[model samples]
Target: MRIATTAEDHRIAVLAALAIAIHVLETALPSPIPGIKPGLANVITVLVLLQFGWHTAAWVTALRILAGSLVIGSFLSPTFLLSAAGAGLSLAMLGLAWRLRLGLTAIGLSIVAALSHMLGQFLLAWWLFIPHPALFKLLPVLLTFAMIFGVLSGTIAAMIHRRLTIGTHQT
Candidate 1:
């Protein structure tokens, strides 16, 4: 028996591949703190959310996390758990933002997603791995990085989105 696939599936696969490549490359970079990377892969997620709506964005993100984890050999590890938590929360936040019709642009949504992703990971780490009050002390610093990277990725996403939108119209 064969299964059928839609163009949407191909689109998701391509986007997920791009995101996974970015995710893997990011793992190679050095971070000042353990989990303080720029999360540049999420630039793709934000772009997907802006262009394709929440469902497609969710598919792309879920595939990215699962496949990225597998490729990075972090599947079912603590790192994977943290990533899953962060991504799940981030996607949920984006869904809510979309449903609310908040009229937020890519930058606004990216900032929101980044902050929520950090919070989710921090909370999971505190509750599951560390379970220490001292962990809360790092929240502010982590959130600061999240904010900075959020803007950076958001700006990149916005530029790409604009370019794609313009290209679509030109043809």
Candidate 2:
């Protein structure tokens, strides 16, 4: 029997594809520090969250992580684990913010996700890989990068959202 797919499914798929493309492309960019690349793909996630809802954003993000990892050849690896943990925590924070009606804009939400994502990955890496107090020193730097990238992605998302909204109203 054939399964039926709704419009929402298609929407999620398209968004996931976009996010995956961005994720894969991001891998090529050299980072000043390991694991310190700007998460431009998350711009799509923030846009999805604002335009659709947190549920759709979550679906898109999960698919992006899975497929992006597979494409990047990091599936089921330590990197993947760290990535998953970060994404899971980020999603949870977004959901909480959404449910709590915190009235956060794309920028605020992105900052929250970025900080949570960094913390989750750092904690996991410390517990699983390094297990040294010196690792804690890196937290401040990582968090600073997260905050910078978060603002950048959030600004991009907001601009895209505004253009889309204006386009919809125009036509």
Candidate 3:
């Protein structure tokens, strides 16, 4: 019925709004790791990808980064590069996973995404500002943390997706 469709549409919108909010809040939180974040917004994206498709998730993730940067006043700053890199890498991973039929349970996918994200940002930084190769000295450390955080975030997202599916089916 039209009513059911409308309600479902509204729920999708609400999920997207929540995704945006999570993006903003996560960005605002200070982390000891310079560019590290839980990327809580990504939870919604992964869920959306599993439920909807890669296209929808990609759009939501892109919007979150753009709007989040504007909200945090880091739109044109060096920090923005990191966020941009992460988004780009995340999107790529999502696409690959979808295409490869990689089950959401694969934590390695998240780790790869995270490593790519860190590399992207570092490459951007090196190209944009730091021309010296010596700057890469910190990469090993950052990469380690990236791997750990990526696994953590991925697990959380997967868990949330499982719960949402259960909730949807129960209702």
Query: Which one wins on TM-score?
Result: 1
Error of 1 at 57 (Å): 0.7
Q: Which of 1 and 2 is the better model by lDDT? A: 2
Which whole-number lDDT from 0 to 100 does residue 120 have in model 3?
A: 81
Estimate the TM-score of every prediction.
0.98, 0.97, 0.82
Write the residue-wise lDDT of candidate 3 on 35-142 in tens digits.
Answer: 767666766776677777877777677777777778878897888877788679778876887899866553555666677778888888888889798989989988
Which scores better on lDDT, 2 or 3? Answer: 2
The Cα local distance difference test for each model comes to 0.93, 0.94, 0.75
Q: Which is the better candidate, 1 or 3, if ranked by TM-score?
A: 1
User: What is the per-residue lDDT of model 1 for residues 1-171, given as tens digits with 9 covering 90 to 100?
Assistant: 999999999999999999999999999999888889899988999899888989988998899899999999999999999999999999999999999999998889999989999999999999999999988999999999999999999999999999999999999
Candidate 3 residue pairs in clash (backbone atoms < 3 Å): none
Per-residue lDDT of model 2, residues 1-171, tens digit only: 999999999999999999999999999999879999899998998999999999999999999999999999999999999999999999999999999999998899899989999998998999999999999998999999999999999889889888999999999
RMSD of candidate 3 to true structure, Å: 3.9
Worst 10 residues of 3 by lDDT: 1-10
Off by over 4 Å in 3: 1-13, 104-106
Candidate 3: Cα lDDT at 97: 76
Q: Which 10 residues in a row give candidate 1 its minimum summed lDDT? A: 31-40
Candidate 3 local Cα displacement, residue 102, angstroms: 2.8
